[model samples]
Target: MDAASWDERYRGAELVWTAGPNRFVEEELAGLPVGRAVDLGAGEGRNALWLAERGWEVDAVDFSAVALDKAGRLAAERGVGLLRTVCADLTGWSAPEAPYDLALIAYLHLPWPQMAQVLRRAASAVRPGGTLLLVGHDAANLEHGHGGPQDPRVLYTAEQIAELWRPYADVLRAEAVTRPVTDADGSHAAVVVLVRAVRK
Candidate 1:
């Protein structure tokens, strides 16, 4: 969707996504030391706010102005002072050099080439020894899992992401992980590709 479309989607009083951080984001990053971070495609800023509350200075970048506004308001409500929201299209946005200790990309679906560009830029923003983490619906999710985009062009595998990060960082973990998803029918598993790496 375009920025205007996303802005319209976010115009509702309620948040589109959950207010809390993504499950995998918290599970993987909870123990990391506090430092400067950037949450690319940071929808409503849940992850950025969480990092800010934990003493990390975070830049939450998203294309939707409405979403960023909601994020800013939530940060104030939570007394989180270290979060900054930037409105920009990730396809053309550039991260400020290798200054961040951590870079997060969660559930941002785009075409393969554009995604590669964004991920590479995100990786470049991380300083040496810093971390880059990505989590999104795996390609296998369409047939073998539940609840995610069904488009095969956008969905990717862990290996594809791992290969992209190899030149810039040392891959630490790369796999398709299953998470529980509960609906009216009960609990079901949803497969997601997760990649974590440390900059060389």
Candidate 2:
């Protein structure tokens, strides 16, 4: 969807997504050292707020100002105040001035070319030895997962992600992981792929 579309969607009171960090984000980053981090397409700042609570200074970027406002309020209500919110389109946005220890891009669906470009830029934002983590609806999500963007052009595979990051980083892990996803009917189904890499 375009920025205008997303803005209107988030302008409503439905809470576009759950108010919790993705399970893969929690699992992969749990034991890592806290440091400067960035959450791209950080809708509602779930991952960003979670990182701040864990002692990481976070920069949360999204195109929708409405979502950022909601995220800011959520951070304040949680009593953890380390998040910096930025409203910008990822396709044209630049990274933070300083290198980050970790960069997270979770469920930020975009066209294949755009996704490749953005992921490459995100990889560059990490410092040497820093980590770059990505978790999103795998291409299989359309067939096996219950919820996510219906367009396959935005969905990715492990192989595609590996190619996206291979030029600038060493992929520490690139694999398709099955995680349980509950449908509107409350039926459980498997969804998502989790890919991670460390700056070289």
Candidate 3:
């Protein structure tokens, strides 16, 4: 969807996503020391706000201006002065040359080539020994996952993630992870591709 579409989606709602951060984000980054971080495709400031509160100086980038506005407000309200909200296309936006302590690309579902381009850029932004975390809808999610984009072409796999990060970072874990989805009837599984790497 385009920025206008996203803006429309967010304009009506006070919050497009949950107020809390993503579970995977906290799980992976909680113990890490504070430093400069970038949250690419940062929507509604969940992860970026969380990072700022935890003492990380965060650059929150997203194409949606409306979302960025919401993010800025959330930051101010949360007493987090460590965040900078930027509105830009992650695929084309040239990152500042300074390396970051962490680069986070969560749920940015583009076609394969575009996704690779953005992922490479995100990885390059990370300083040596810094962490790069990517989370996306697993290709297998078409069959098993819930609450994700429906297009399979935009979905990704662990192998694709490993291949993308192998040259520049040490691949710690690249795999299809399962999440439990609870419903009125019962609980089921959902798949998501999670890639955690540390720049070499």
Candidate 4:
């Protein structure tokens, strides 16, 4: 969805995202040192807020004004004001150059060239010896998963992610993973592609 679509979508009476950070974000970053970080496509700032709570100075970048407003409310409620919210399209944006200890994107899916370029920008934002991570619904999820976008152009595979991120950083791990999910419908699994790397 575009910014206007997301803005309209988030203009709901309720918050669109969950209260806390995404599971993969928490898991992958659990042991990483808290420092300057950026959460690209940080809808509602859940991950950014989480980082702030843990002592990281964070930049929460998203294009949706509605989501940023909700993120502000959430930050206030959680007593967290360490996040900087940037409402910019990532295609034309580059995260600050090599100044961050960590850079991450969660569930931000774009078509191939844009996605690749964004990943490059994300990597460039990371300082040497710092980390970069990306998590998104796996392309294979279309056949086996329950939620997430259905467009293959935006979906990605483990191999595809590895290829994109390799030239920019030293990959710690790259894989298609499965997570258990339970809702009113039933218990099931969702597939995701995860990339963890350190800037070279």
lDDT at 110, model 1: 94
lDDT of 2 at 130: 94
Candidate 3 residue lDDT tens string, 16-85? 8889988888999999999999999998999999999999999999999999999999999989999999
RMSD of each: 1.1, 1.3, 1.3, 1.2
The C-alpha stretches of model 1 lying farther than 4 A from their native spots are none
**TM-score, per-candidate, Cα-based:** 0.97, 0.95, 0.96, 0.96
Query: How high is the lDDT of residue 97 in model 4?
Result: 51
lDDT of 1 at 152: 88
- For 102-198, candidate 4 gives per-residue lDDT tens digits of 9989999999899988888888888889998989999999999968899999998877877777887888999999988788999989999998988
lDDT score at residue 81, model 4, on the 0-100 scale: 70
Instruction: Judge candidate 4 at residue 156 and give its lDDT.
Output: 89
Pick the TM-score winner.
1
- Whole-structure CA lDDT of model 3: 0.91
Off by over 4 Å in 4: none
Candidate 2, residues 58-153, lDDT tens digits: the string is: 999999988998899999999988999999999998886799999999989999998888998899999989999999888998897777789998
Q: What would the TM-score be for candidate 3 when compared with the true structure?
A: 0.96
Q: After superposition, which runs of candidate 2 have C-alpha atoms over 4 Å from their true positions? A: none
Instruction: Please give the lDDT score for candidate 1.
Output: 0.94
